[model samples]
Target: MTRTLSIAIKENIYRELRKLVGVGKISAFANRAIEKGLGELEKEQKREKEQLRQQLIEGYQKRTKNKELQKTLQVYGEIPNERNEYSLSMVGLPLTTDDLKKFLPVEVYIENTPTTGLDKPSKILCDSPFTWNKGIRFKKRLGVVSKEIIEKVKRT
Candidate 1:
């Protein structure tokens, strides 16, 4: 299905097209060029649209994950630190301030709280299910706190 159409072009461009393709074959050359250019443009547009769609999907997934995290954090409540700073939840993990305080020493928990972005207790110590010291090393300030020092401290 071929339709006749009239269009104007720059004089220099028209002259170059006439010389390169010949005046008699200009229609064929122009038709082929237009088809090739339009195909490339369509392909580029499709790629761009797909990329945008993927980005939107990723963004939606992140928002959904964040909402779930907020709900989980609310269950643990806020933990009060020695410095009076409190954190309702920790990022990247579901561990709460009270959970961290259970295994960590009074002093070591205080030191690591700011670095780990979690809260700690002032003096209270509680029985923790975590018996190993390896899991409590959240930040650079994790050090061995003597049992005597931890026991001597009074609960606040």
Candidate 2:
């Protein structure tokens, strides 16, 4: 269900927005921009909450009963049911660099930080740097190359 919303803003700002996104797109542009701003604010709040959770986990690990944690896990409310004893790790997907590299050619280098691996510089046997996706665009070709590299490494 959708309801029409009416709100007022500065005339100059509204004019500028109209010029940028056009009148027909103002509602959608405003919605996306507002939601992105809200998402950033929520990310900071979540970061703080995660920090506190980490501290609690650290404190629990320091306990002498950390070794014999069956009853301790129960006391900490970690035992979810009669069978389960602990919580699972939350996964942020699309593979970490360390893991993803295993699927790629070793001659190719990947940027270590802020991992959009496809945007980073890499090379084939120190030939020249290129973007992961565009530079080394041949996945099928690289698979053969990678296997050869592995076989050579194993023999040596």
Candidate 3:
């Protein structure tokens, strides 16, 4: 099931997104972006919550070790987090956008046959991943070393 939603973006960003995804796939591209962002936020929230719980536990134990605060805190329902206790019941979430752009491949696939008067070559910022890091020249140098190692092992 899908619902219609409208959003406004800057003209330049919209143009860039269209070039990256397609003319009419803005909605799908936005959805994929949001989903990926949400996954990262969830993991970060989990990590922060665990860190906070540990801090609270440490604070409570330090207070209790004094002997006087221990009896006082015990009188009230509030206690240390040592018994696997947490104050936060609801999940709330909230990194690196720069590193992603550095390594990830940005590509566009052409499948349909070219139509007359509609196709033009566009200047792209980076070489296509399929061409950039492929073929004999780009293949691992480790292959030669591995072959030498294998030959040596066979002799032994």
Candidate 4:
């Protein structure tokens, strides 16, 4: 047995119900609409949560990577002080001039201080100067590259 109840609804809602009543029972139509709406809402909420989770994961990964890069640069003496030039002794594993060329798109400017000797250029320069625009544009690509490189290094 089925039970029926008469309930008052807003004018606009009643108008909408009237349209659907021609094709199906008002209760059935309303119940179907409510179920469909809930399903769509559930899907939207799940998508939003997943997006937030991914964003958080990416943010943490980026922060960790930046810290590691800073440490690596420090260990290799690649970090220049007030003086823009890097000492040859400081350029160590993973932080070589070649690595900078391969990884960074910006022009690598090593200001070599003059030494007491023949007037030959002190510093060696690469073929192409690094540019931030190039590197910045390729950030997403470089991020994938860096993650792979870090994982490989970690394993070794």
The top-ranked prediction according to lDDT is 1
Q: State the lDDT of candidate 3 residue by residue for 1-156, as single tens digits.
A: 988888889999999999999988989999999999999999999999778766765565565545543332110111122331333321110001223334323322211114211133211122321111011112222111133322432332
Candidate 1, 72: how far from true, in Å?
A: 22
TM-score for all models, in order of appearance: 0.41, 0.38, 0.42, 0.35
lDDT of each: 0.45, 0.42, 0.40, 0.39
For model 1, how does the per-residue alpha-carbon lDDT over 1-156 read when each residue is reduced to its tens digit? 999989999999999999999979999998999999999999999899767656755555565534442222221211223422222112221223455435554322333344333344332333221211111222233233344434443331
| Tens-digit lDDT track of model 4 for 77-143 | 1222233232112221222334433433322323222321212212223232222211112122111
Question: Which rank order by TM-score, best down to worst?
Answer: 3, 1, 2, 4
Model 4's lDDT to the true fold?
A: 0.39
TM-score, candidate 1, is: 0.41
Report the Cα lDDT for candidate 1.
Answer: 0.45
Candidate 4 — which residues are off by over 4 angstroms?
1-8, 66-156
The weakest ten consecutive residues by lDDT in model 2 span 71-80
> Model 4 Cα displacement at 44 (Å)?
0.6
